[model samples]
Target chain A: MQQGPDKRFLLLTASLLAALLLGIIVATGMGYMAIGAGDILKIIASRLGGGEALLTDLEPTIPYVVLEVRLPRILTAALVGAGLAMSGVVYQGILLNPLADPYTLGISSGAAFGASLALFANMTLFGHFSTPLFAFVGAILTLLVVMRLSTFNGQISAQTLILSGVIVGAILSAGISFLKYLADEQVAIIIFWLMGSFAASTWQGTGLVAAALLVGLLVSLFFSRDLNIMSLGRRSSDALGVETARVRVLLLLTASLVTAVCVAVTGIIGFIGLIVPHLMRYLVGPDNRRLLPVSTLAGALLLLLADTLTRAVLPVEVPIGVLTALIGGPFFCLIFRQKQKARSYE
Target chain B: MSEQELFAIDQLSFAYGLRPVLDNISLTITPGRFYGIVGPNGCGKTTFLDLLSGGRRPAGGTIRFLGRPLPAYPKRQLARQLALVPQEFDTGFGFTVEEIVLMGRHPHIDRFASPGPEDWRQVDLALERIGIGDLRHRLTGTLSGGQKQRAVVARALAQNTPVLLLDEATASLDIQYTLQIFNLARLLVEDEGRTVVAVVHDLNLAAAYCDQLFFLRDGEIHRSGAVAATMTAETIAEVFGVTCQVGWNDFSQARQLSYRYRSHGGITAAPSPAGLGGSDGA
Candidate 1:
C-alpha cells in the first residue's frame, strides 16, 4: 500500500469521524442509566453553546451524569487512545520497525515504574499531580538513555535501539517488581492502577489529555514527510536531505513524550498503540500524512468501544486495559491475515 | 571538462573510531565527468564516496563544493547539489516504488509542501528512465533485487542534483541493468552536465564507462587520472591483487580489463589482446 489522498480516503476519514461521534453518543447511554442519542446530543449542544437546555424533558441528573461525570471519562479514554495511536505511528516510522509501538521502546514501562514508585512512596509533593509528574520525568530520561545507547559514530541503528529498549525495560520492570515487594498496604492500589481504568477520570484530567493530544498530533503531522523518508532507513533519509539525526531525535522526543503523558494518565493501556496503526495502515497505507487522522479516529473509536463493552455489556465490569487485550488480540491476527493477500490495493 | 572544479578535496582524511579509513587524500573533480573509484574489499572506496557526498564528515583537511566549504551549507541545500544512490537498502517500510522514488523529490519539496504536478512528472520520468514505469505501483519490498537496485537509482535520478554519488550501487543488478545504469550515469554526465562519482565493483564496466579512475589501497590513493592511465594491469595487480590485462577493444573502442592467472611478480608477461576486439555486446 502506498500513501495517497484519494476520494476513497476522504470518504473513509469522514465515515470514521462519524462513527466515532456515533460511538460516543451510544457509549454515554450505557452503564445502568440509559439516555437517548437525541437527548445526549441536545445536552452536549446546550452545554457547548452556553445556551438554555433544549431537552428539558430529560431529567437534569441525566445531563449531570452525561456531561459532568460520564463525558469526562469517555472523552479521556478517547483522547488517550488517539494520543497513543499517534505515538505508535511516529515510533514505527522513525524506528523503521513495524512492530514498534509506545511500549516497544519501553517509554510506557518507564512511566509505569516511576508511577509505581510514587504510589509506594505516597508521593504528595505535587499533591494529586506527583505520580504523573514522576512518570513523565522517568519516560523522558529513559528515551534519552535509549538514544544514547543506540548511537554509534553519530548513527543510531534500529537493531541497537530495539536491543537497548529491551534491556532497559527489563531493568526498569525488575525495579517495579521490587517496589511492589516493598509496598504492603498500597500494593492493591498500585495493582489496580496498573490494570488501568477511567473510573477516576475528571474534566480537568480530560482537558489536560486533550490539550496534550492536540499539540502532539499537530506536531506529528508536521513531521509526516520526514517520517516517510525515514522509513528508507538512516542513510537514504540523510541522502534525501532529511537531516536524519535532527528529525529522528525531534520525532522520538515528541512521540515518546506523548506516550509518556498517556501512560502517566492511564497507568498502562495496551493494544491501542500497537493495533490502531496497523489497522489504519491496512485501510489507508503507510503514508504518515494520510494514516495519522484515520488512525486517530480509529483508535478513539476502538478504545471507546472497548470501554463501553466493559463498562456495560459485561456482566462483571473488567478493566478497560484487560478488555482491549482480550478483544484487540484476536482482531489483530484476523485483520493481519486478511490484509496480507489484498495488498496490491490503492 | 569546463575548467571549473566541482569538488576540490585537499588532504581529506577520516577514521572510524581509532582506525583510519581514508588518509591524506587530495583530488579535484570537474563538472560533467564520470569518476570511478575501484579497489579490493576494505580499501575504503565507499568511505571515500561517503565523504565526497557529505554523508560522513572528514576527520581532517578540507572539501570545497562549488567553491564553498561543504559543511557551510545546510543539509537540505547540500542535498539539492548532491545526491547519493546508496548501496542496496533493506527497506523496512511498505512504501511503493512510486513513493520510494518520490522521496528523491524531498530536496525540491519543502517540509510543509506536497509534491506538485511538476514533481510527479519528474518522478514518472525517473521511473520510466529506469525502465520500471509499469511497476510503479508495486511495493518496493516485493521487488526483485535488480528491480530494487534500479528503483534506488531512479530515486537518485529523481533528485535532479548537480552531482551524484554511487556506492557499489550496481553490484546487485543483473548485467543488463548494470549496463543500463552505467549508460544513465554517462548520459547524466555528458548530456545533463552532472558530475558523477561512483564506487564500482565491476572493473571492466568502470574502465568502459568512467572518464577518470581513482585506485585506492590501504586507505590511500594508489593512482588517479584518466581511466586508460591508471587502469593498467600492473596497477590493478598492485591495488586489487589481481593480474589483469588492460586494453582497448577495437570494436566498441572502449577500454577493457581482463583477468588472467599469473605467478608472482617474478615473471612479467605481455598482455595478449585476443577475442576481445569484436563487439561482444554484453
Candidate 2:
C-alpha cells in the first residue's frame, strides 16, 4: 500500500505548517524589544481581519517598531526563504544534482555583480527599485547563458550545465571584484549588501517575492511527477510520456525566474536554498510534491530564525548570509553523515 | 508471415552532425514478435533503439507507427503505445521502487491528478510480475545492480504499452534474471500479443529469446529474418568480426552462439549488408 509516504507526508505537512506558525510567533517574540508571543499573534490577527487593534496594551513605539519596521523585513525574509527553497528543490530535481541550489547555476553571483554595478554607479535612478531590477536582469541573463551552453541537439545535459555554470560564475565573480576595486567610497556598502540582510525590506518587495513564489510553486507542483521520472535520466522520462524537453525548459525557466526575483530582493542570501531541501528530504522523502512544500515552510522558519538571531539575540548584528553558512555547513555535514550511515543499511 | 506491421520504416537515417550513426536503414516490424538488434560495440543499436522509441527523430526518411507517420502521433499518445527500458538507470535520487513503478502510469494519469488506487494496483501488479513486490518499500538507490535493472524493467512493464523496447535492459542482471526477463518478453508476445524490440549484447540470448533478429553492422542491417535462420555462424562472424560456433540446446530447443578466438578462414568480411549469404558485395 501507499500508506508510508502518504501518511508521513500528510503528518509532516501539518506539523511543519504548525512549526512555521510557532516559529514566526517565537521568532517575533525573541527580538531585542521583547514582544510576547500573544502580542505578536494579536498584532498579526488585527491586520488579517482588517480592523483596529484587538489588544492595545502595548506601547505606541512597540506597534510601530513591529509593523512599520520589522514586519516587512520579517515577511520578506520568510517569503524569500520559501521562494529560494522552492527554486532549490526545482533546480536539484531537474538538474539531477543534490548539490544544486538557486545559486548553483551562478545566478547569485550574477545578481551580486548587477547589484554591485548599480552601487558602484550610485544609480538611484529608480530610487529603491534600481539595484533589484538590475539584479533580476543579471540572474536571468546568467540562466540563459548557462542554458545555451549546456544544450546540444535539442537536449540538455546536467553535466555540461553545471560546468557552464561554474565557468560563467567565475567570470561574474571577477567582474564583481573589478567593480568593487573601482568603487572608492561605496565599496563598503556594496560589500555589506553582498553579505545579505533584511534591514531595509519593504512591503512591496515582500509582495513581489510572494507573487513570484506563488506562481513558481504552483507550476513546480504541476510538473512534480515528471520531475520524479526525470531523475531516472532523460531517456526513461521521455519513454514515460514526460515530453522531457518541454518540461525541462519550462521548469528551468520557472525556477530560475523565482530564484532571480528572490536573489534580487534579498541581496544574495546563501544556504537557505542549499540546506532546506536536504533537511526536508531527510524528514520527508525526495518526492518533489512533498519536498517542495515542506522545504518551503522549513526555509521560512529557518531564515526567520537566522534573521531573528542576527537582529535581536546577538549584541552586534551579523550578515544573515554568513550566519546561515556558518550554522548550516556543520549541521548539514552532520546530517549528511548520519544520512549516509542510515542509507548504508538499506 | 502475414502478421500486421506495427511499424513500417523506410530509409531511416540519423546522425550527430555529419557523422552518421544510422544511415539509410529500412525495416518492417510485425506485432507479437520479440525482435533483437545486435552487433559489435558502437553498431548503432542504441541509436536505433532511441529512434524507434521517439527519444530522437530521424534525420532522413520516414517511420510509420501503425498506419500513420511516426511524428503524427502526439508524444503522450506515442508513449501510450511504446515504452522503453533504458540501458542504464541513475539511482542517485531517493525514489522508492513503488514510486518509480507508479510513474509508468503517467501516460494515463492526468497532469493535475495523483495516481489513484487503480494506478497503484497496476504498479503493484508490475512489481509482482517482475518479482520485486517484496522490495516495493525499498529505495531504488539502495538496490543492487541486478535489482535496479529489474526495477527499471518493471517500470517499463508497468507502462503496459503495446510496443516495448529494451536497450540492454538485462545487461547488469544475473543469469537467472536474464532468463526471467526473456521469459517475460516471450510471455508478453505470446499471451498478450505485444511487440517487443530489445538491443541485446548476448548472442545466445538473442537466439533463444527473440523471434526476429536484425544484425546491424556500420549503421546498416546486415541481416534481418527469423532468428533461427538469421543467426548462423558465418553471419555472426561477418557481422561481429569474430569466429563463433552455432549449436542447438535440445533442452531449451533453441540455438546457442559460442565464441572462439581461432580466426575463421571460411567467411571474409561481408562488404555490404546484402552479402550475408552470398559473395556479391553490391
Q: Which candidate achieves the best DockQ against the true structure?
A: 2
For candidate 1, the lDDT comes to 0.83
Model 2 interface DockQ: 0.56
Q: Could you give candidate 1's per-residue lDDT for residues B42-97 as a string of tens digits?
A: 76777787788777789999999888888787888988989998875755567788
Please list all clashing residue pairs in model 1, or write none if there are none.
none
Candidates in order have lDDT scores of 0.83, 0.85
Off by over 4 Å in 2: A53-58, A343-346, B1-3, B247-249, B261-282
Q: Interface RMSD (Å), each candidate? A: 4.0, 2.3
Per-candidate interface DockQ score: 0.44, 0.56
| lDDT, model 1, position B115 | 84
Write one digit per residue (lDDT tens) for candidate 2, span A178-286. 9999999999989998998898898999899999999999999999988887888888888888888899889999998988888788788888888899988987888
